[model samples]
Target chain A: MSLAPWRSRLTLALERNPQLNARYLQLATVGADNRPANRTVVFRGFYVDTDKLKFVVDARSQKITQIEQHPWAETCWYFPESREQFRISGCLTLVIANYPDLALQQARQDTWQELSDAARLQYTWPDPGQPKADAAAFESLPPNPKEPLPHFCLLLLQPVQVDHLELRGEPQNRWIYCRNDVNDWSTQAINP
Target chain B: MSLAPWRSRLTLALERNPQLNARYLQLATVGADNRPANRTVVFRGFYVDTDKLKFVVDARSQKITQIEQHPWAETCWYFPESREQFRISGCLTLVIANYPDLALQQARQDTWQELSDAARLQYTWPDPGQPKADAAAFESLPPNPKEPLPHFCLLLLQPVQVDHLELRGEPQNRWIYCRNDVNDWSTQAINP
Candidate 1:
């Protein structure tokens, strides 16, 4: 059979993952000491039509620098007690800053509203090296139809390979699917 | 304030997360190439009494090897809609075969039985590199009235630091709680 069947399964699997929305993804990158450094990021959205995942990153975040130097990245998503998981590896690209997509930025702000009082404090103060924005920063921009942040850019990831892992028994089984150059996927049961 | 207050809060959080019984944890390790490699492992149980997180791993797994070489590791858990997350980093140790009570082993086995058919398939055909049951390997051996799988070991991680990330609207906040050598915890808010 043509690999179409497996491609369909892969697409469906991505859709089945409820955690894919605003999921917490940990990106591992090489640090100054050559040790692995990982931090959590919010998943903005996935383009099932294009088989691509989208996120936002500060142009100056340490991770952005690491990804630029080494494009290979691994992302992990976990939901407690849920039998769904995604361990994906792919190359990431910076969507041009001028991409007129305020919709994504609005959705991100909406999701941010759902956090607790304690959680809200985390973002009010940017981490060292993270792009800084102040109250005046938002005031200076014209409110005609968009919010302006010079450092804002959409980050798109085209997954090269994804391993869909389900909670089997003690020895977890993994279906490793790889996307061909043409964006089609092939699945194989690898040694879990 | 007494530390008991915070510990009690943690207890409530754990209760709210009962479904956490089955969680996917990403273990980041230094690969031979000096880059980071991550793998997902199911959390077996938590020793609340000892304040340790427990999980099973194949003695031959790459992560096990990595831990042997470098004990520093990070574990992360998140809920997408809740926008709440738990991140843990600390030293990890592998429990020897002669550990845990017989009752506990039986309880774990019972939980294993509750998994669905697809889940059962993962362990039935054991992966050589993962932890699994080998009935034939144990057939000739006398059933140890004490412990099952005398070769299997549970890995325990004593969290040195734990961070909570909350992504509510307007402001995002992160709180870090660190354990002193004396077992006392100090918590403070950090920039997100």
Candidate 2:
């Protein structure tokens, strides 16, 4: 991933919404026969150095299966006030514990703090990732304390294409930016 | 469709926000490959007598194709002040003009006025409903004084499920209402 193009895209998105890093982003993955599945997760943080982005996922959600099937995904960040939207389509990678870092934990906590109590409860109990109480499956499973710990997994996305759509008046303004392997940005103006 | 369940879902959505009928809804549709495609359309008044909703759309958009191929689509309306969002997944209908209504035009014009001049100038032109160019597109096209007059097309939706997600604090709250029959509404709780 080229840092130049991503830096520009992230700068605009973050400038318009410094709080967006704390907002939830809806990640979509392709499903059977062209169908798509979506799930909203809090934004973990972005790594400008590695040109990567991270989010937590429960080990059991069907979304995990969808993500694993198709690593390519698109995310939408909708902002109401600015009537601005930032969309990116890219590839994802699941980060393992070998990536443990204090900085990443702090970033995760910052994003997590933005959620509501009920939202937190979804990840608070013995199993943070899956739907509550799978009686049929639970009866056959062994007792495991870490089961409820969300099996918290980190998913990273490296954006390949970014589009910024801003609504001001009649002819909406849109800027499309693409990143090349050489770490440069090519921009174009398209009719909105 | 079962009116009871549909109506219940609609009621839950409307009750959570009395202004839903007046607010703008952004519908996101994707191609068979799950690429992102979106358009801003109004929440054309819902049917009080039936489990249906309406919106004005240009036939040119790819959204029509996606909806035609796969009836399942999601619509989202975000309210920043309340830190709440309302989403629905449902089947769509291409409403013929024979449906008969005067408020339809009024609703469409009202929605248009909400758009900025640039957006209007760039994307919208006096509707001939046919493939006619904008003032600019027309100028580029050969002078043809004999083109057909513009027309408006209406799209309708029959919702199957509705989810209301409100973010209050550390956790979020969500309410799910499913349409069972014409007038039946089945309500359930889901993790936020």
Candidate 3:
């Protein structure tokens, strides 16, 4: 229940960079055929007070299948304003209908409720990565705000290793934090 | 060689975002134990007008080992000024001393000569990702700028798939360009 050592630095980054796009980060996963797949994913904030980072993905997205095959992922976030980067290596847990965790299932629902109407409607659109639909088909009707569609998934990234690099420094300050099996994190400053 | 379809958009992004950090991108790769690893890397530009994207890395970096194990990588670049994202997924080719490509070896030498003095000095410093060295040890002596050090490498990413997403649109615009084995590219407009 203790705070992650990098938490304060991440907090500082968020406070210093107020741009909405600052919340967007890159999520990289191993896809089918073991190809490295990456895309821009919105950072949905930490899961409660835990180190787990929250993100939402449509069940129909290729990332869902990629996660199913290989859950290991790395999230690279850069705050342009602060010129800092954070790369968190972790496994992603997709909260789907049959997923076992009831608490997480509830969290999924809560996350859905918190989404903007435009964002929620995206889940109602035709599946991503598919051939383009008609322009009219792109305009989707707003779905119910209180509940998530079956395909909407709350993805949680459980960080096992965190790398923070500050680009503003003389030689660029870099630190790596690794979590033990018991969840204790040890931090080390390394050459940038 | 013909240009990739996404090239123009990427060019426009660079033109609009004149910040030095605009060239910084995230490179994700499968590392030791099949875990995902990622970090920020500088984009060094195209290789002789080919589709390959260039980057530089030290031989002492962990990425070199990871590339030896799994060449697959994804480069995710976001242009905050233009609100555009480019994700290039491809396998990396390390142009080392023993690499067979003569042109690339020369390209490596050319790229080495183009680096700033400070950037070139980084390779002379203590190995990255290693335990923190003494402050005095951190100040490394400059190497010959005309020639790259033994461990300096030119990493080329031969992009097989290029995903360009424009976040400025209301629904966002995404296009994925895929290359066939013959190097012919086919593009698709997919739902964002």
Candidate 4:
């Protein structure tokens, strides 16, 4: 896929913000009760050769259920050094076991192989969002790097709209990019 | 309104992160189309002696319409210095002209007065989220501090639940604080 217009801008922002936290972003989803739920999630990089952004989430996490129910979500990412913000709204695709896409399954396995042993160990510890357990309960052996556990799922967001804001300008600058049904992206500069 | 269980932690976080961006947060709301909409907004301090967090919004902005349709929203704040994150979920209250509460009207005016002249002039600019206009259209004069424009609104969030996560700990830390109908808050540590 050719690089999206907004994607290039985001790449520049990421390049300018060299801090590690630049990969951290806030993801929002509609909960089962219809209340808005949000949390910080790390960007696992773009899905291999695709425009879809990749993130890792435990299938046992609360957000898994939220995504199953509503499917729609948004991510807000801010680059402090660049003083820019990107709000991308899209549908979340959770790649769980038996996800049906063989390529994505291979991608998930590759993503698991890329994680550090410490991160992979946490997935074997306990169910997330559950009541805190004793410290001894977290001493599980590290999982194999080649094979991710059943619950270690890849969360992909295929963006449909992007609202980017640059806060360092005199009056500031804002742009909205919308992808139509035919997958054509149209952008407009708007009042900030 | 007494201090919520999660409020004290957030207070400490703010004190630790002395940077200007500490007050900026990502707010997420369900849009008119049922898709999640997220944006970065400055935290304009709390309402007069109440737990309701106050924020200013351009009534002409798209979020105003989104919030009008779906009042629920969540604010995700990350403190880099403390390595902590707070996801506060709640219902939104918009105080516009002809609002019933006299006290809130006073609070809204007080909030308007706190903005810088440059910020105040933005309320006089053309509609937000609209197509690009000529550069001269944004040269509107600043409004009176004592009397805010009709579209200058106070957006308040009365939190119902807070998910606080600290990424500094060995296994990390997470707590969920929920407020019941009677306004009492209960907190529980969760697996992170």
Candidate 5:
């Protein structure tokens, strides 16, 4: 399938501002209480072919549970220096240690291995959001490849809609792209 | 009522990192479709006495409608320089031109006046989230004080729970504060 025209534009924008694109993005997911919950997650990369935004998270994180209950999620990413914001809403799919798909499991392992040892240490810690006795306790547990942290998970957000807003220009510039059933995108310029 | 100990700590943190605290924060609200939607909003300030977070938006914004339908919302704020993150979840209350409370209406008027004329231009534009014919059209229409933009609104988030995470530490530091019925806060250290 041909790439969506807006996808190329988004890719070029990211290329021009690599620092902003790679920085932390705020991910919003519907909580069990039906309220919207949000937290910062590092933006890994975007897959043009599949139209998926990649990010890594601990398998046992509360966000994973939230996404499991409601696959729909939205992310707000702002490039401070560029004065641009991208609001992306989509459905999520998780790749975990026991993911049924072999290819996805292998991909998760590769991503896990690429993380720095210090970063990987987080996944080995006790369950997140749970009360901890002491911060010092985590120091005892280091990243151990032999014990493979089953909690390491890869998250993929397949975007159905993307709203881009450039706040630098006069009157600002805003556009929204909605993906169709066949994966083609229809774009509309909206007032900022 | 006396301020909660945790609230004081939060206040101190914001004071120490004023730039990061005052910058744009990501606000998450559940949309009409029951999907979590997110966008960046300017951080106005925190009301120490009332324990509320304040921000202003056009009354006709989709988020205003979203909050009206479901008062519960979440805000994710990250301070890159400080390597800190704050996840605040709460119920929202709106202060509009015709709000019943006299004090709130006065507060909204004060905030509207404080905004720069260029910033106030947004309220004068056509309803946001709707398609527009031309971006240049907004340039022709300036903020007219006599024709008060009735759509200008102030939003207050009374946080029920606040999660503070400091990623600068070795094991990282995480704490959550939940406000009880009497407005007192209970704090717990959680695994990061």
Candidate 6:
């Protein structure tokens, strides 16, 4: 990866302790009706070589369907202590646990296994966004099977644009980094 | 306004102290390319009569342009302390300071005047999202004029759908309230 100065700065920001503003990332995706939807998704990791942000999701989630219909999405991350905001726009790709690519499939399995049993139970629930019969029914549902759920998938977001806003300055500082067709990044300082 | 049980619950949540979770609200709007964009916007107020969520914004902001292109938007707000999330989808309407309606215009003036001088100075800055020269140039710029900047706008989001999720439940509880053709809200329990 030919890291530009801004890219290096972003890398360092992400490398900071996850406890310090790296874990919770807000994801935005276009719904079926062409409206925008926003939700909080835990940040799994970032791949510097591919310039992709990774997260885990249940395959049956509404966001997964929205992403399939419209791959274009954005993520907004705010670090309250630093008073900095990062807005990232990109295309999303879903890698199923049983993908054809051996390396990717192994990576998905490793991620799934790394999750706590309680977290993995989320995928075992009924269809999301569907009407439920009763609150008690949730407890009576069958237990999760021994193997990993088939509905677990890894989502990778490859960013096309990254806008960083730092509110510490007198008038605030906004910077935009855009990736060119040749995979090189160009940076500019924009008005806040 | 015929308040449903869920609607009452939402109103109570918002009425809580601003220090709790009523101050910051996440806004989602579609970009020019039909991609979703998410950011945090302060919650100025909620209009029960009109069923609108009100906030302030700079008229020159990219979100204003995006709203003009596609008014459909959604806002997701989470209260970590309460473990509650409110997902609201709606159409946006911008009420300029010099609006035709006398009451609204007066309200706009009052809101603008109530803002601290430092807060109102944001509207006097150069166009947002545009490239800037240097950090020092911001300090050298002229002071904000006595009059309210024309770029200051009151944004009202009229909700068509409201989803409330409470994570305190064993399996979590999700309820969706959708507005029908006649402007009446119908509530349903959705699987979490």
TM-scores of all models? Answer: 0.65, 0.67, 0.96, 0.97, 0.93, 0.89
Candidate 4 lDDT for residue B102 = 96
Query: DockQ values for all predictions?
Result: 0.20, 0.15, 0.74, 0.78, 0.74, 0.68
Candidate 5 stretches with Cα past 4 Å from truth are A20-22, A144-148, B16-22, B144-148
What is the C-alpha lDDT profile of model 1 across B1-192, one tens digit per residue? 244223454555556555543255576655555556566666655544566677766554566667777666667655444455666777777664433676446544444444445443333344443333444432232333333344345677777777776665344556778889888888776545
For candidate 5, lDDT tens digit of each residue in B6-111? 6676666677676642478899999889999899998777653677888988878778878889889999988766778889999999888899988888778877
Candidate number that wins on TM-score, 1 or 6: 6
lDDT of 5 by residue, A109-178 (tens): 7777777778787776778889975655676566765444888888999888999998886778888999
Task: Give the total clashing residue pairs for model 6.
Answer: 0
Which stretches in model 3 have alpha-carbon errors above 4 Å? Answer: none
Evaluated on CA atoms against the true complex, candidate 6 attains a DockQ of 0.68
> What's the C-alpha lDDT at position A121 in model 2?
45
Model number with the top TM-score: 4
Candidate 2's residue-wise lDDT over A1-192, tens digit each?
Answer: 435454664566566665553365666666554554455556656754676677767655556676777778777766554566667778887643333776655444454454454444455434333233433332333323222233445678887777677766344556677877975667765544
User: Model 5 — TM-score against the truth?
Assistant: 0.93
User: Model 1, range A1-192, lDDT digits (tens) per residue?
Assistant: 243333464445546655444255676555554545566777655643455667666654566677767666667755343454666777776654454566545544443344444433332234533333553332232221233244545666667777666665334555777788766777676555
What interface RMSD does every candidate have? 4.9, 6.2, 1.4, 1.2, 1.8, 2.0
Ordered from best to worst TM-score, the candidate numbers read: 4, 3, 5, 6, 2, 1
lDDT of 3 by residue, A142-174 (tens): 999987899999999999999999888887899
Which docking category, incorrect, acceptable, medium or high, applies to candidate 1? incorrect
Clashes of each: 13, 38, 0, 0, 0, 0
Of 2 and 5, the candidate ranking higher by lDDT: 5
Stretches of model 2 off by over 4 angstroms after superposition: A1-10, A18-22, A96-122, A126-150, A179-185, B1-26, B34-42, B95-152, B169-172, B180-184
